[model samples]
Target: MNDKANNIKRQIAITRRDELGHPPLHLDNNSRLCLNCNRAINDEINIIEADPACLRLNVLTQSASQTCVICNAQEDIGRLTIHCRVNVFIEVNIYIPDNVRSCEHHLDENGMFHNRLLPGLRFINRPYLIKGPQLQLFLQHLRNVSANKVKGIDDKNLTEDEFKCIAPVSKQQFEELFTYCDPVYYNGKLRQIKRKDLLMFLCKMRQGLSDDFLKIIFDYHSRQTVSSVAACVRTSLLERFVPTNIGLQSITRENFIEQHVTEFANELYNPRPAEPKVIAVIDSTYAYVHKSKSFRVLRQSYCFHKNRHLLKPTLIVAPDGFILMICGPYFSDAGNNDANIIREEFERDANTLREWFQNQDIVLVDRGYRDAVPLLQHLGIDHRMPAFLQRGHRQLSTEDGNESRIITKNRWVVEARNGHLKSVFKFLGQTMNLQHAQNLSGFYRIAGAILNRYHPLINMQDVNAEFARQMLQRSTVPNAIQARVEVDNLRLRNGQWRRLYGEDVPDFPLLDLGYLKDLTMGIYQINLAPSYIQDKLIRENDKELQLDEHINEPGFLRIRLFSRFRNVVKHQIFIAYTANEMENIDNNADNNPISGYYCTCQSGARSLGTCAHVASVLWYLGFARHQPNIKYPDTSLLDTTLDAAYRQPADIAQNINVDVIDIN
Candidate 1:
């Protein structure tokens, strides 16, 4: 049996070498004669003498050991056995088919010749060095295995939600980007992972998933490989996607004016005559980072406001909430404040902000950019910011406060844009590793680019300039009730202003939500009114309500309600109700039963519409109270009565020095 196997192995080696372009070796006549089988090679048959060195075979003798015909026949059977094993291994989905064998040849009890090898030789345990045709076959088998594994990803087998969880874009969008990027290789090899899978890696990174978790989900062999793949994908996205979609240079001034600027042209306080062609809102957003080992870095990144290590990146967004450009991910130190960043941008002309911004082009900002105002003025750029309250004053004067509201109303979009970027890319929300601190800017820019291209406009529709103008006009109107309250010192005199409670709740004019929205000029405040009212009612234990009936104005009530935000502060508001004759209010008519209202809240002070505080009082008094036994939901999580530090103090009333007006 061993001799037969050896003879078969020799024949296979010779045949493989011949197929590999090696000429057949000549065999001597005596050497072609088999000693044990007693068969001689026929002269008509061509056969090669196997080289023991090349074949790695143990030949029993130097010559006449085996006949070429017997070897040839054995080689054919061996080849057939290997092919059968290969098919079985392939069918069973074996990744590496190293062992293949044929059945042992033997005589059965019935004297029939059964072609099967001995039991020991039937299945080979050793892996042979496969070459030539066998090597090609093995590679082809590997190809089949890989194809099956990646078939699902290539065919987009994942559902929409599943794809969304794994990638920022939809499957269709991913495919389109993949085609555009055409990333063919990664880590110096032909990419085994599909383009969608690569993008999934990037998306998962943005979602702030750990490498270990990603590896388990993506079926990666190691976390290091996952990191490498993610890095490669990030590089590709930065090189291929970010440039065209982000940065000031990517967009033309004409396009910016046409698409984003024109909408705010007629907006209140839009810096006209100069006819501000563009209005860009700028603000800095913080990204928390792990404390660094380097003391200098740790000190520089520490933010006094957040009480943590943070990186602040300044974002400039168009009125439509498009992120036009991203500036330095400057350290949170005082030197890198928003104003300083803008100053540096002007000095460096970063993204050509100085060149692109024309004279009288408006830059809407928060008070943080107060220092930049002088610089902007020097450049002939108009800057608008919310008015800051004087050190002792409780609120800005009517005109100053109203103009501040206009600035705030327009500036809020940039804040929303910043929030959108952080919310969509959770990595920015999480505390970043110290090691990855340098990559913060790259990630920020990339997230901004993605948002600019995919997210809906922050301000979905153009600002209603007419509504804004009306609001501006309303803001300038002096509040007669507030004026009267202040003149009579009604807030300080307890007898003049009685605590308004359950039975004292005045009759407020009933108005529908549409009418309320029209009065407020937006639904946000009206929608928030319920939650604010509920918070005052349930969370603050309804302890902050007061009414002044001393004024001779009939059907008018002056009340001071505790501020939802500040424990020690309260806002004075006025509500005017109509006579019973106006009970049946027409929804479509401009004239409503609610004749006039005012609240000291910045927005409420505006004449165009009422603030949420005034709206809440009217809704609760007129509509909500009439719907008897209906439970109002508590929308606030804060327990101001219990959680507030002032509430905890035993002498809280004395410390605050304000009357603890109680509401039943």
Candidate 2:
């Protein structure tokens, strides 16, 4: 077998050399004018080879004079003029003269013009002859180029960062993925295109670069060839790679449960303590596409909610952020909401999803899948969704709010999974061409499969397990502080308000990062904390408004914050804390000092997680004040960069004036 492989390799090499039209080795000792130095060309002289094909094809070339060929500069620019090699001979079977010269700017970082035809190169008519060392140099250049072209994006050339940035995978992960492509067959030949083509395809997906750009990057001859290679790789991966990593058939239902099921999901959504159910979070993400020429397609892809032309793909992810399945990049038309799309999946029974779903299995979804709740029930699949407000209701009840928080806490992983897909495979983040509409589904599915197969789980830490337990413990707890504030009519009636600053609230509970995370139940609210506090400080400094304090009850503090919305409403936040009267008590401790908290906002009264308003105050008193020189992002520049448009008095009066004129 080894002897046969050697013979095959030898034959392939000989065939390539023959196809290159390389002349057989012959002795030629004739001295000629060198293209590089304008001197005699011999075995001892190093003559530069210019693109001679430019002369035959009438393409652009620089003068044979001493000045830089590209710029035609008369005066010396203090830059070295390089004598480029005969890439033209490799290109169009034409020999470049030795007298041509070009500046360093035209050359790439490798000091060679990478396969591209340089504009300033001087081409000559005569056939360039070389002997001994010159001929050996030419052959060596050809060999090096061939080797580099074959090597492509292998581990030897690129660092770990470069590999990950280009292919979004480590060298180790790339090697494993290459195993599937190494045995790839094309036209009845095994390993026909090699793993280099696989790297090209992955680089395209990760960078979202143009075919032309990718051709230049990967050293391909044409954009058409690049497209062909990508197509071949896509087909190969879809057949052999995607099926093993993603979709319902990738792993058994039991195996998926055992591997990807999270403690948080189990504790939050599992109704039966005896039986462990498959907890999956379902969500839909959109990929924006350019407007199509066909009106029907334009209408089909237009999404009214987003006010954009896009396609929607439904992502089903496990609680541990493992992508279970990706379904339909269906039209973003009015008819295809998350509910409709999911219903279609069940109706069509795509990938045996119906069979995969067990009776007691739980699916955590947002309000977008509310309409599909009845269908989930009919299919014997348990689904949990956030609570929806009635038409007249201003806020969710404490019970409803807490339940919604629990559902959302588990459902957030699907969103993270979607974000991961977009971040790693940047192709999905941008507005894709309408020409690729047919391949959009394949692109997302392939990306999903790659992420599932190679990437680490989003929430795999032991700390998450502890956080989950805390969330479960607080799931049924009601907001007692919220009830007390409502009963006492604290919001309705005005009290003698005192201005509250960080220094004034010394008795307030001090919070650390971990405690803040526990209070919010997620980093999202904590992230918004600094910005909210900054806004409050700016408002206080401007004398427009301040955080007004109303403290009638001991160890209970009340402060009102302006709503983040455009409305002129403010939410009254109440925090019940133990006063730090003892001098020996640890002020910076991460213990539960702020015993109870509540706000009157829509989802604020939840015991499971505090609202952003309450979180902001707590973050300021406990965290932000403790840290010195906490510089928030300068958002004031946004106001200075552009002015908000104000309606002209004439424009506003135009409609009324027209009405008056018609009446007259």
Candidate 3:
């Protein structure tokens, strides 16, 4: 009986069917194909029933559909499909259905949305279906992306101040520079990265950080990666960016004269020029480098003047502090001095520099370029340099001093521009590595271009036009006070002078900042006023004589300040003023109470301006002492330290014994 029943059941199971003449339980939702695909019902005849063996298993699927959401490509669905991630929707604000398929070409190898194709994402309003594991995976991935974005040197991660502090350019300037960079590819890896590499290059220039440290900050895999990135960025900038911003070829001589030339420069150098001629200041700045193992390179790079191994890059800048061109960063040896480097630059005519500079153009330089003056004259270029001290003269003559002051005032722009360059790109100022020595030219060019494009003009002429006119007017006046001192032989006699205090002189002229600035014609001396006064007040060594203690007579003050370079030498300073002057007067007024000033410094005899020592004395007696609770520079740290060069072993032993360590 059991055998007959089993045979009947097997026959019935083999022939099992529903009302639709299909397999039994064929109407189940799990077997529904028409809902998942928009195919005809008959085409769904090949649908296989899903096994219900593990009802709790939640396996992740590639997508709910075979078509790519990005490009709508249907072929090779299984091989080329990339399931969209949660970050894609969050970043682009285009909803990507969970497990939506995308072609491999549409996404980056990192499985992220392509930057170029992200905007083309099709709109989808369908509800998302995510399994538990998929949701958990997405949450973890999002956490990682967020953390990396914050921790890495990404543009979105840093604030405007942070960008300037790290890189030298503002946030907007940094962003604007991206348009000039070329987009390179790692197509084999299906990844495209940029901008951050440019930023890394800037950071390298601005902070002067080592490759290893840069690698850590930028999340690069190794120091070699950082170096390669820097190299690539530098090349890109040199080719695409630098040519349009810096160098002699970038700007025309006519445009430079019209746009960059300043009134002060014109009046000081050319003096009401009839023809359009270029007036620029030229100078060289040192870029310190590490000592090399090769003796030849060491000999070539060593600078005896600066006492360091370095390179010299000659800068050509307009009087308004606009950089016009940069020349060779030649070796720092004797053969590659400033004059030779500049002479070579002119001789080579690189980038048509010789053509750019025409005849009658004035080149303002310091005394170091004296050898190049003949060459400049040969080329029909007028050159103005500071006057060299004659062999027998301890001081420059009045005419030489006046002419040199005008040249120095115009030449100051180049020095200020050099300092600006170092401040912006610290790599130029700092001691660079030997590995970077070969790329110094490219580095300097890039730095100059960026500085020109982004930074504001330094030492603008409009702010100093009146001041320059005043300097010119003052230069013509004779030093009446100096003549009087010399005629009376006041400097030779000490018996005529009497020791007196500030109260003893009841008629000294009290001055304000503006009057003092007019007397000096610049702020450099005023900036040093507090420090000089502080030096006297501190009295580190009591052997020095005080200026206020030896006033000679009413309406006159005299003092001596030790030479900065030589302590054994002293400079005599004298100031004559109207008695009973208790208030400040207009700096431009003719009836000024302070009649004249004189000093024994090399350039002190010039009536155009007072020497630093004279300015310090006048500033203190007339202005600084009258102010209450003035905060001077702190010198406590310096006072505590001893000079290693002058320190004796016995003195060291005595100090060390008092603070000796007790290891026992």
What local distance difference test score does each model get? 0.62, 0.70, 0.71
- For 1-664, candidate 2 gives per-residue lDDT tens digits of 1255344333433443454466643323342223542332221122223433322222223534576655666554223222245465665554444455555544533344533344334443322345568667777878876777663446558888888888978888878887776334444433233456778888888988999988777777688878777776777778878899998889898898788886656766786644678989999999999998999999999999999999999999998888988999899998999999999999898458888997878898889888899999998998888899978999998888888888877688888888988899888898999767789878988898888878888864434556667777787787888888788887776664565655666676556667677678777787776566655555444322245566565566677677767547877887888765443335356656888988888988888888888888887776666555455545545444655664122221221111111100
**Regions of candidate 3 where Cα sits further than 4 Å from its true position:** 1-150, 184-193, 460-467, 536-545, 548-553, 643-664
Q: What TM-score does prediction 3 earn?
A: 0.78
Q: Per-residue lDDT of 425-542 in model 3, one digit per residue for the tens?
A: 8888888888887898899888889878898876642345566677777888998878988897888877667765555665777787777776776777777765554554433343
Give stretches of model 1 more than 4 Å off.
1-155, 180-197, 262-266, 271-276, 460-463, 498-506, 539-551, 580-584, 587-592, 600-608, 626-664
TM-score of each: 0.71, 0.73, 0.78
Q: Provide the lowest-lDDT 10-residue window in model 3.
A: 655-664
Q: Which has the greatest lDDT?
A: 3
* Candidate 2 off by > 4 Å: 1-155, 182-191, 460-470, 540-545, 581-592, 645-664
Ranking by TM-score: 3, 2, 1
Candidate 2, overall lDDT?
Answer: 0.70
Per-residue alpha-carbon lDDT of model 1 for 221-285, expressed as tens digits? Answer: 67886776676666666776888888877898878877876444346656452354778889999
- Model 3 error, position 414 (Å): 1.5
Query: What global local distance difference test value does model 3 have?
Result: 0.71
